[model samples]
Target: MEQRESGGMKILFTGGSSFTGYWFCRQLLEKGHEVIGLLTQKRENYEGIRKERVERLSCEMELIEESPFGSEKMIDLLKKGTFDVLCHHGAYLKDYKSEQFDWLYALETNTKNIKQVIHLAKEQGLGAIILTGSIFEQNEGIGNVPLRAFSPYGLSKGLTFEVFRYYAQLYNIPLGKFVIPNPFGMLEEKRFTFYLISQWKRGNIPAVQTPHYVRDNIPCDLLAGCYGRFVEKVFVQKGPFYRSNPSCFVESQGAFALRLSREVSKRSALSCPVELKEQKSYAEPLVRVNAEPAIFEVQEWSEERFWDDYVAYALEHY
Candidate 1:
């Protein structure tokens, strides 16, 4: 393993095809660090976007199509490679659709595989392991709250955090967990925000099922930049990076949607009527996580600027 000039870290980044993972890779590259991506076989169109971004930036990055769950292969890579940190952003997010046995199996497999990765990292003497968590782990909008994961996907994330924290403490590894809220930006697939924008563009009133149910939405790019800075702080500054309580960075989802709709209307020259529909019988709880001051210090984008950038990007891409 060759050392980089001026102490630049070599990061082993997982989830290369994911939107957040791609943004994180781009930000790390922008900061003059070496990144090697470990991707799965299920490649999406967004992988092309990530590749294009890497090419456009002229940054040298390696994409290896391998499973992180391959314990022997992963251990070999960590032991032999020049990786200083393992930035794990990979996860299976799809729910098991009421298949209890399948969900339990997936949960067990994910937890076991992640534990193996952590053990490998510790054995290889990596500097730090950054786990990208979700706000669903928290019960309320407060810090240090108990886990209240209702869905299978949320349960998986919450359990993963517990496993990561356990290993970090047991092995005395510097582990950082970033509890992400709803991140909206230039996404390859049309999700809630994109669907709303499409409806608005077609001069249709987008129905808001949960108008009162609030969420802390952060722009994907801003979150990625903050994560990059967090990495730099952890490795370069040699600072303590362990956070038992997940840090939440976000804005009101209803307000975010309104701003997005207005921007879409302006961009498309169409009247985007926002219809606040009656709440459904089965409504998801308001996911409001409290933001830590330490986390906010690294993030630069404000709500207004985020909307502006988001609208422009969507108009160009979507």
Candidate 2:
């Protein structure tokens, strides 16, 4: 890898406007790294959460719009790349929670320029290719007796990594896999956390359907902080291949909902309530969580500050 400045490295970042992606970009910037966000969607589609993320991040860094993963445009950018690293955080997320996800299409789209991109990484002297992974994918992380993939999307993610890792090996370049567990925070999606907060705001009691299944839920900033440190470690150490599973809150869905309720109620005026259903669905894994933790630790994290930020975001958006 070639050295440019004395301080931080420049990264070609994808998925900067996504919920997690947005947080990751902010964390990277806080660590003094330069983030050149390559957006997958157009300005018109950058509405709601994406729009908010784009608007805020645009003020902080450079953003190139409408660049899909493994596309001709992205490859062209890589061809002229002067980045220290490539952070591939964007994945095909349409219907990602469904069972009918097209793994083949996603796989093909994710690695269309696999060979060329790896070649470029070597030729351009990029430090490493960091691929964002998922803990729900089969054989990833710890826990989950069998550790089977949660859905077709998980399968697709696992497969995508396999192909990317294969090429990285072939090119003899450094590659790192940063596996993500469930991340929640301010400006996040209307997921379990948001759903519960919404119910509390409307004086409704929310029910957690998959209450019994154990999973990992983490704070977004904490995870991003860990990632920021991970990027630094990548250049410092020799990484033919490496992976980091950043784990935090591990508990049942029902317990997690109640936990959120407690945090929100203590911090805000809203009274939150939750109900844990008799989980009858065994479609997903019963116990699936991450293995590694130190790879993504944010040294400055404070639980109190996290809730403060979380409540502030909720008050504004919700």
For model 2, how does the per-residue alpha-carbon lDDT over 208-299 read when each residue is reduced to its tens digit? Answer: 89999888898898898888888778766857988888888888888888888889989888888788889898888788888665424666
The digit string of per-residue lDDT tens for model 1 on 49-115 reads 6555434333458776555544466666876854688887877655433435244555565555666
Best TM-score among the predictions, by candidate number: 2
After superposition, the stretches of candidate 2 with alpha carbons farther than 4 Å from their true spots are 294-296
What TM-score does structure 1 among the candidates reach?
A: 0.82
Please identify model 1 stretches exceeding 4 Å from their true place.
1-3, 42-60, 96-103, 113-116, 138-147, 236-241, 244-252, 293-308
Instruction: Give candidate 2's whole-model lDDT.
Output: 0.84
Provide TM-scores for the models.
0.82, 0.96
Error of 2 at 154 (Å): 0.3
Error of 1 at 212 (Å): 0.9
- Where's the lowest-lDDT run of ten residues in candidate 1? 243-252
